[model samples]
Target: MPPTDGPYDGPPAGDRVLALDLGTSSARALVLSADDASPVPGALARHKIAPTYGTGGSATIDLHAYVEGLLGCLDELQHNGHLDGITAIVLSSQWHSIVALDNDGGALTPLITWADTRSVEPRLDPAFDEHAFHARTGAWLHRLYWPRRIPWLLSEVSAVSFAGLPDLVIERLTGDRVTSVSIASGTGSLDLATGEYDAEALAIAGVKPDRLPAIVPSGWTGVLAASYARRWPGLVGVPVHPPTGDGAASNVGSGGYDESTAAVTVGTSAAVRVVHPIDQAPELPWELWRYRVDDQRAVTGMAFSAAGNLHAWLTNVLQLDEAHQEPTDVEIGSSRVIAIPFQAGTRPPETVPGGSGVYFGLSFDDDAADLLAASLQGASLEIDRGLRMLDTLFGRELEVVLGGGGIDASAWWRRCLTATFARPTDVCAEAEVGARGAAAVALGLAPVPGGEHLKPAAPEVERIELLRPRYTILRDLAVQAAQELTRYTSG
Candidate 1:
């Protein structure tokens, strides 16, 4: 048994459930107390997501390292006595990942994470229409999706099949080779309307349907594998729910079950998503993506390649102590600079190569603090554009429920969002929305659990109003930069 917090008497152990969140750079496990609907104190454990980076934007995770990170969390849970009381284990993992598996289910290659860009030049079939492809799969034609990577992998590696990270982890845990519908939806191979492998997509990618795992509902539950059972006796027969995409879990975890509220997530990347029941597929803009959370609800959103990654870069350039911390009381829109915030290139609207960052209106008088504020403001402006576009699609302006590693920690980040959109913003208390959402799905919570909501401050309103003209200028500059980059890449 693990050490206790103290001489504490709370609800019995049976009311808790274990939630595991596998992300891009780390994995976290926590025991959620069903009695109070909160994570048990001192039960949260995290391990770094150390991926091996190579040249040409190649980042891969060794299968051993990935499994060890998970095992490390389980060890901490066992040490802290979190497993004994847990009734079930639920999982949420990063989307858009593919792992090649051999004939015997052994990993043939390091997991080709979502960040890898080596498949940019795949041999695409001329019969395949990219727009129609996007319409059917609800994912754009990009290197991140399977359409580009699968064909490239077939040419380079001798692999029999592939699976996403969530399904791979589930196989390791439960000896099952199945994927949740939510996870499959992000693979760029599943047809959104049919919820099955798309024949045309498979034809284009030169992949067979059998190469993918069986698809099941996100709430499907199974038992732990015998191997893991022997290793961890406490979890021998604990029910394990099928794993879903972390983004879908975050929507549920942040209380975005209906159309009235949207989920705003800003971690390494940023996105603005809204969840609604499937009602004949709303006419979405060309840039937006449509993914199913389960069988009934569809999550439509726009994603950005830049967010906290941009913040990290600016911090290193500015030499700040904290990457996300706001500098001392600077007025918004007061700086004479505007940053493009596309140091990593634009993800939505289109993927542009060589789209370098642009700092417009920079003057000699401006210091690092002013530049940093301007960059943050530029990102917020892009977010504002997405929000407005989503509103047009939904035919109504929706309130936002903000949650993610980035927004959960920084008040300044939250303030920027609230002021930019001129709407009420609430900070979701659950920093690990993905994990909390997994637990909620296992426990059958209708709305999941959302954290605190922080309202906009009065002082930021004036500053936000002053940014309207600057926002127009920023948008124009971004368009021009993207256009120039497109021409250069084409040339």
Candidate 2:
């Protein structure tokens, strides 16, 4: 796609920005006031998307179906007159999903998401140094990134080009195949020092530079293609900004724009991130990743593969009712059972190959509520480990701001997290943080106001302090067992 003539002038008063958030399970669109970056009342549309799962660790979504769902959202917004006076369009999409494209820009394979584990044990060249690669790309040689996924997919199918889901969406709208640094940084290919794809990493993935989308800066803007202009007449000349990673957008929206404040988001999965200037970021840690928010800012953090998904699985398997799922009276660290919550495997620093969830110390007296409480506690402990690492990285305690659908729905889980972290945490009140953040990025605005301050109770904190050592012991044992099991099975 060709670039717009010049930088977009600030929107006039009363104009709005149409923000789209493409997540793992849904496509959402909302209108925000340009003046304050607040969502316009009743100017929102959403469409649910279901990904296909397979027994071979495959997780994918039909590319055309996903795009059509987003367009359908626009159709609804347009019908409701929400497109009037729209000055620009911005988007936030989940990172690390890739789809292969044919020469005509058509998808040759379904979009593979971060949850897919088909490449978990990827074969790499003997000369590849994992630490050196991580230093250069700000990503690990893990299945969630392109380096592993690329070779695995190529062996199974043939394709000419590869792009993330958002890249394809941008191409469909603007007739351009371009991606932002923020998105590229998550692919395990971008070089932090150069702000471009690393040639060595690309060679490992067996991809040429020409096969990938052009790398664009964060604030880059393009106009809708002529075909799309006719489809949505009101947006004929509106400037559309490149897609920002959903994690970075969440940080901005939740008021965690600098090193002083850390954002913790728990949806299908969970992550903790802090934004800092790209040049000023601390040395990369093996336990965490550093992804770009744009050309100037980088987000450093760790992600957990299990969060809400673990909660859902446990609740279903235990046959818990609504009342049991959110038991208010359950005391922190009170349950006799201990759990290693790796229902979807592990990530960074604490990785366990093919590891699954383990419930230890279960007795005949234990009920579903006891198991559920223990499971949540296990997940909280995992997050707490990552937070402590962040504290050490900065050499000081940072303020924590929490958001995401999981936290909003469960007061019990919030209590567990607070007790585990033993710090004051603030919960964001905005329901559409990703969309609001995307608009803020496009408009050059500050974070909006936050909501609900939570301070850890002294007694609960004391209880967690005692329980943490036991949890640590169990975690170590679990990891050892998993490693031995992998070796035994392979041999």
Candidate 3:
């Protein structure tokens, strides 16, 4: 479609829009010059997100700490010259995190991170069924996201109000208690049919309709209030907009927004969201989310949560030997230990959640490096499975554009991903697609679609090792085990 908004570097206002990317790891800002909607001259600011990883039980983020981190980044921009011409900000974050607030807009509970998958399915008074809920909202009835946590809070805590991470923060920043359709669409509560809150979802989540913010399309133009200006001295009545989902922005950053194009994202989790014709909502083996890119288009996404957890577990936690170095694939290949790699709960209790690295080929000679390499290999294989599911569900070959943490480090894993996928993968120049995607929303720019715009990303510079599809038989055996494991563990 046509450009929704102009590149707004004002003579009175300056020509750049300040796009803030609120992410799980960090809060970053990109000042896009209005003259051409390009990155302006100066320090693009960022602050590392405060870590709130809970080991005792309920994993979450410190809402206060996160907000402070966000401010810290904005302060950095203000301290530098970047905030002068900046007008608007667009936000993006990991899906399914829950943060409850009281009527006064103060956070009431710890922001439940996306990784919080405790046996915490609080009951819905309306008694919604998983399949029925999934069909209506196009969300898997799993414990990983908002559908479970909202009900848990309403039943457990009196007078507790809640929304996903993006909504709560955006409300605080803009003084407008509103959410974007693109942001809300990823949650299980939205009615994909109408792009509004579903009556059934409200009933199930025990949320009052008025408590939730109004949902607007991404890239909408609205002014910032003076109170916010006082809170954030840099807020000068500039227009605020929606960058939408982190994955959606990555599509734009990598140019995966077209009807036929799709992005295969391997972030903390993995997913493939293809923007397709809304008139046809085809059946999908993984998931089908309604995206608000334009007015009519919907993006169906298939997600896998355990993409990088395997590598994290092995490299960081499961330390190999005295050298303290991560292991290589060849070292891992000589060993015979097979890990299932389902540390995180899957989308559903079906063939999802392919858990613990099954020791099918373990040997007495297995070393730490060997085991570590095997773990990475297992993760790559599962990612490949997710890709195959996307192809099967979409009934089209997706030109996979890879981004996020999973595809970045572990040179062995990157090449292994290529080989296991049995397809040529395009790694982005910068791996922070979530931030870049959100920034582009404020810039009114599209990711040069079909991976065509990515600058000559030199081959093997990032060290891509393509693993041919030799382990297809082994993965087939693992799927049966995965299905069985899901049934046993889904309680």
Candidate 4:
């Protein structure tokens, strides 16, 4: 079928592409000019959506509602006639989400997100070789992945099929039963050395090959479904690339497509990642998850399950307002209220939840501002720990390319990161880097010129001097806290 040229008066088409980035709490669409890596004026749409929070760390979203939100974004782009002259419609979506489907492709279960922790209750069998499992699948036996979640899911439903959210979304858009290697790599099921599902993982999940989609390379593409094409004439025959996990896309979008630059993002959670060829996969750390960016390249990183969400939660609890929220040097330094910011959870090097948030040195003199400063400092310290591990794992001193909404909004946090890590850092240029990355993958690498470098702010001499000693104290205390939590939980 020929591509449709609609009669609507649209912006002049010139090397434009439609890019969609589906995040945890929002869906965003951008009409980007691939020629210069810039979004076309007035062709952007964003909508806020969130998962339904349940007890016992259950984070879920309605599959139908998610699809409708995505479609709504696309419809807004269509209404603006921004789909004109698009090269391809590409996607980047949140990782580690599982959905169960019935025979007619209807959802039988809510999309269980990475944050869902019900699977943590299942104890991995002692006979199970966790190291071998991690080596084969490039994932841990955590509740975030399919290993535990799949078995736990089976106990609740009798769905005929199961796949990640990306797989289902791609199937809906293109009528193809396919998933990207990037997406599969995050599932705790795909063999890292081979771009296929691991037999052992499938056996553990009690799933068969029929329940999963065929894995494709990150840049693989298929034609849009004819049924959907008839509804949006402009997208009728445009190539729709397979969806990629947002982590890899974020790396590409932030210009961390190679080993020289490490990417750090802080949204609801935080992560530290570097995309390199599979040859660079480190001497197997049981904690660091290595997932494929494509057939040839892989992303090695640690995901901290707690980050900006903690910041938001504290702000609300303290009733903090803009008036008292000034992030001055004094506020940054004078706050001796040290906090261990793992209220959500912790990943890798530990692979267990940090159990709780702890505050030290909180005295009667401390106020909300001091509490806020200490919390930010706690987050910076966690990122520092992850960065140090990544450096050791990769055997390179990677420059930091920081992204995500929470970190971008706070100069104080960036400065704190600089002092805490004692490394070069830069805030990423494109705020919506995940979408920019999918666009780059589909159209080709059109880098946002000058986007990768935000010069690290000068560190305060006294603050650095103070933190140098306190960091050791804080690190030791955090390690002790985690050890205690581990011992108590096991007992």
Winner on lDDT between 1 and 3 is 1
Question: Residue 236: error of model 4 in Å?
Answer: 1.2
Mind giving the per-residue lDDT tens digits that candidate 4 earns over 89-176?
A: 8889998899877887678888898778777354546688888888878887777888778888878888778888778878888788
lDDT of 2 by residue, 236-355 (tens): 888899898998988888778889888888888888888888896798888889898887888989888888888888788878888778656678878888998877778755557544
Judged by whole-model lDDT over C-alpha atoms, candidate 4 comes out at: 0.76
Off by over 4 Å in 1: 1-14, 35-37, 120-127, 322-324, 447-459, 482-490
Give the lDDT ranking, best first. 2, 1, 4, 3
lDDT of 1 by residue, 227-294 (tens): 77656778877777777678888887877767877788888878888888766768766888888777
On residues 377-438, what C-alpha lDDT tens digit does candidate 3 reach at each position? 66666665656666776777766676666666555666655655556666665555665666
Model 2 C-alpha RMSD vs. true structure (Å) is 2.1
Query: Relative to the unseen true structure, what is the C-alpha lDDT of residue 163 in candidate 2, on a scale of 0 to 100?
Result: 96
Each model's TM-score, in the order given? Answer: 0.91, 0.95, 0.81, 0.90
TM accuracy, model 3: 0.81
Candidate 3 lDDT (Cα, whole model)? 0.62
Instruction: List CA RMSD, all candidates.
Output: 5.1, 2.1, 5.4, 4.2
By lDDT, the best candidate is 2
